[model samples]
Target chain A: MKPFGRVVICGVGLIGGSFALALKARGLVREVVGIGRTTASLERARELGVIDRFATDWATALDGAELVLLAMPVGQMLGVMQAMAPHLGPDTLVTDAGSTKRDVIEAIYSNLKSHLEQVVPAHPIAGAEKSGPDAARADLYAGRKVVITPLSENRPEAVARVREAWAATGASLHDMSPQEHDRVFAAVSHLPHLLAFALVHEIAGRANAEQLFGFAAGGFRDFTRIASSHPEMWRDISVANRHALLAELDTYITELAWIRALLSQGDGDSLLKLFSEARDAREAWLAGRFDA
Target chain B: MKPFGRVVICGVGLIGGSFALALKARGLVREVVGIGRTTASLERARELGVIDRFATDWATALDGAELVLLAMPVGQMLGVMQAMAPHLGPDTLVTDAGSTKRDVIEAIYSNLKSHLEQVVPAHPIAGAEKSGPDAARADLYAGRKVVITPLSENRPEAVARVREAWAATGASLHDMSPQEHDRVFAAVSHLPHLLAFALVHEIAGRANAEQLFGFAAGGFRDFTRIASSHPEMWRDISVANRHALLAELDTYITELAWIRALLSQGDGDSLLKLFSEARDAREAWLAGRFDA
Candidate 1:
């Protein structure tokens, strides 16, 4: 396969900066040019050796690039894609690293499919509680999973090229429909994050919450670590995936209510039984009995 | 500074067996005897070298023990203490490792104080998700916190002795009233566990929850690790610490309701502000700004 001639990573924050580092370290691309709204991140990415070169000008960064990676927040992916569409090299392979795929896929399919048949929506399931270019690490994608959703309009060559890109980063790949991806993630990724975000907001709003946190043990600290994730990133994911997330939120509330009702009624047996099953399932998952 | 002549560990499960191991390893006690209703665990604890001896007879275990540590289910600590009252050695330092203190302390004060004056109710804030004797580790309490609640009749010498014993195992010690311990723990430890338990239970009860978890990323796995902890242990804790746990549950529910109300009304500004604040506070806490 021909190496990516000049790859452009849009909005080089945590994910983008990491991708930039991975591409440069793996020699997948001869030159990696980063484009972000802010000059600080671009300069930091260059200083940190995440990118071979950096550019604040989108048009200049996209010039002569064979691949364009949308690494901006989900809410801004479309706008970035629109802005860079005019500068698309004749055969540039366009892709994104957004968590939610359906909306982003739709935006690209409707707006850019006429000019490009190389749009492959993908998500690398790798990140930490930290954010920004400084937090990016070259080995972030090692041993991680990357899911790609390709539509009928996507070129087979383009899909294979994206697969090669992720494989070069040492990420295992999976294929699924956009709808299936969103639904599954709503239960596992999106819902859990939303619940954590809400829990933090609730506890922090309490008058004595700070004093309460002073005594916070390891469990609470570990559980709420993700609650500290970037708010704009989470807010976009929540709103972009609103329908499925709302459904998940409703389901969670129902189950919570069931436990609450059992507690209120002093139904020890049911509570015990419910807790036992959950514990058993969780243990199975932890012990590798269940493949989660 | 004489070593404990004999030590009795009730409910020789993970915490109990680990306490036995810690004492035996450090030569803090001459004899470490375990008492539990489960003959299998008692035998296993002895076999694993967690205890020097075993006794199914609670009365026999307590007979000559200078230090009696109740490491049983939170719900059963009171009953066990009452039963062992007649056998408690004179001037014995009685303490417990139950997670919740207010209720346990009240039980000891009301029922066991007539026979023992040095009741130092404590919670060694450590342990793994797994349980039973096989899960016990001698260094389980290393670098962990152990909160002790001293009663009015508690002897200063006894408190110091208990502190030294835990210190031998490298546990940092903290002192608080039973009420303060309970309230603070409700926010930090109890609330997080319940949240995780409830979330896991909720997802489990969903029609597609099993398949959903197959796609669960590392964040979901990390956040819900404690959900895999012993259910019988958590149930007993929730029931025993009902008053405080209930208060925390109420606070959490209120927060959820507030967010739901905002979402329903499409109040993005308020939701964004609340989400942002929570994110900031959590970030600060994770960056080592908090006590945890």
Candidate 2:
């Protein structure tokens, strides 16, 4: 296989930086150009050998670039896509590592209409609570799941190249429609994050916050661990996937109300049945981890 | 310090068995007698060295018992108390390791009214997902928090003895009223557990449960981990603390509604603010852990 002669990474952060390192580690890329919002981060990427060099603008960054990975927060995707519209090569492949695909795909369709065939969106289901260039690891995506949500206009070769690029990083490939991707994630990933945030926010705003937190133990710690995530990133996700997320939140509220009624009636036997079903479900999920 | 000669532990599971082990490890108990609803468990507790012997009846178990610890689920506390009332010696200091203090205290007052002076209600804030005699560890309560909700009727010497016993297990002691203890725990511990159980149950009931769980990752795992806890135990805690837990659950529902409105309006700025506040609160809580 021929090497990617020139590749551009727009974020130069964890996912972007790690992808750059993984390609370099495999000798699959000739050059990796870092372009992002902050010069300090690009400079850090350069100094850390995460990229061959840095670019302040897309024109300079994408000039004859064989591939581009838009790995910034989803909120910034539109601006980046619009900026690259005038500079992108006719056949240059573009991909994203956004958490939410439908919204990111919409951003791509609106801004890069003519380049839709070369645009592929993917989500690598791997990350740390920590972010930034320093946290990037070559093995971050190793043995992880990388979901590619391909558009109707996406070129076969372009999608294959994107898949090959991710596969080279040691990730297993999976496919889902953009809508299915968003809906599934909204139910599983996004909803849990929203619930955790709500719980922590509610307790933290209490006048007796200090005293309440003093009694929090392992369960509270694990339940709210995601609450300590980067606020801006999660804010973007919650907003972009708000439609599916809102549906999930509503369903959860209904479930809670049902539990409240049961508790109000002091129906311990019924409550026990619900809790046991949940416990059995969770245990079954654990036991059938990969199969499930 | 005098040893607790003939100490009897009802319901020899994780909390009960570990208490027996912690006491034995410290040479604080001369003989530990195990009693529970099931003969199989009592036999297991004896065989595992969690207890010196096994007794099926409260009458036989309470004979000459210097101290008695009701380490059963809160739902069974009333029945056990009623059975022990006739056999309990006049000076046998009684204490319960129930998660909910108010309900357990009510049971004590109703059945052990004359022994009120000898009964001290305490809660050990340490536990495991696993139960039964096999999960018992000699250091289970080491460096954990044990809160005592001393009844107005409790004698100073009896309260002191209960506190001393818990402290001897290497746990730090705190004091609170029954109402206060139940309220705080409902907000921090019980509510989180209920929310987790509801989430697991909701997803497991869905037609796409297997698919939904297959996509679930770290966040869902941590957020729903407590849903796998003993259903009967959680049922008792939820019912016993239903009053306070209901209030907290209602408060959380209100918070979710507030978030839903923000999302409906696409107010990412407000969402960001809320998320940042939550992140700050979580970080602060972690920093002020012991002090808070």
Candidate 3:
């Protein structure tokens, strides 16, 4: 891949910082600039070599920039896009690492309408419970999945440039429509996160929470591990994809109602069949992932 | 702890096999007799040194048995108790490693009425998704919690014997009433397993399951890891503790509705607060577990 002249990362947290480090590791960028809401965070990212320097304004950050990544939470994407739209270069390739694609795409159309061809929305399927610059790793995206949701107005060359940029991070990239991306993620990713958070919150609010958690073993720990994720980041994701997510949540609640019925009726045979099918499905999924 | 002259294990699977192995590890038993429906399984247990010999009948298995541990699914406890009660030695210490307490206590009362004084019930809080003889580990219970829910008709010495036997396995023992035991586990352990299973089943049944699973990452894996647990075992547990589990499910459904309302109303502030509270509670719970 041809190396870009200069790249700017809007949110130099784990995703953004790691992208910067990964690009540098591949020698794919001549120089990287960090931009964020806080000067201290930008300074920390610069000190950690995640970026060469820090820019406080979009005009300075986008000046002569060849590529830009909006890695902030979805809630901040619209405002950031508005801030950078006037300063965006005519040929700059812009992409985002937001969790939701449809919302980000909408934000792009609403704020960066003139740059629609260059604003390709993507989601890197790599997240940890931890965040911030220090949690960044050069290989965080290695062997992970990155999905690109190109807009209808996007130029082929611009989408190719965005995909190639993610490819430099050693991640396998997949393409889908923004609507499909939001729907699939709302089912697999967003719903699980919300369910996890709810479980922890329910138990935490109980009068016998101490007693309950005292007996919680490995199962509870793994099932609720995502509840420890960065709160604001998840809040942004959940709200940004609210329509698709609400649908998925409704479906899951319906499924839970089915299970509640099975248990209430004392249908052990049906329960066993359901659990067995689930186990087989999950086992096959894991096996397929490994075989891939 | 006093060593038993002969120990009888009914199930000869992970829990029972591990119990036999832990006792042998501490030289707390001179011999362990294996009893099961399948001679093949019993033979495997003997060959694995989980037991000294196999017995086809409960009478022979319980002959001169100083201690007996019924470590089978709660669904099988009643039948096993009925079979063994005929031969249970007057001074024999009887206990179990069932996950649910009230059902096992009911089984004890119904089938082993004459042996009530010697029939103690206990639950070792150590469990793995894996099962069978080969999954048995001598240190399975080491540093794990073991809840002993004594029968109201039991001799204090019998309860001590049950507790000491588990203590010999290196587990820290706690005492709770059988009612409390069922309610607590229904929240912490059983509910998580069912939810995981339900989520996996819901997704696997979808037409786009392959696509959804393909993009699933660490969060999804951890969130649904328990879905791959033993189906029959979990079915038994779910059925055995249906009442408490149903209550938990209803409460959780209500909580999900509240979250749904928040999402539908675009209540980002409330959502953030909820997630932050869950994260803080989980962090504190994890910290307390580590400190303990």
* Candidate topping DockQ: 2
Q: Give the backbone clash total of model 2.
A: 0
TM-score-sorted candidate list, best first:
3, 2, 1
Deviation of model 3 at B282, angstroms: 0.4
* Winner by TM-score between candidate 3 and candidate 1: 3
Estimate, for each residue in A196-217, the C-alpha lDDT of model 1 and write its tens digit. 8887777777787767666666
Best by TM-score, which number? 3
Q: Report the poorest 10 consecutive residues by lDDT, candidate 1 chain A.
A: A283-292
Please write out the lDDT profile of model 1 over residues B74-191, one tens digit for every residue.
8887788778877776677777899888778778877886754677888998856888999888889987888888877767888888887777777888888888888888777777
Stretches off by above 4 angstroms in model 3 are A289-292, B289-292
> How close is every model to the real structure, measured as TM-score?
0.93, 0.96, 0.97
Instruction: Considering the two chains of model 3, state its CAPRI-style docking category.
Output: medium
Question: lDDT, candidate 3, residue B52?
Answer: 98
Write out the backbone clash pairs for model 1: none
Docking class of 1: medium
Error of 2 at A126 (Å): 2.1
Clashes of 1: 0
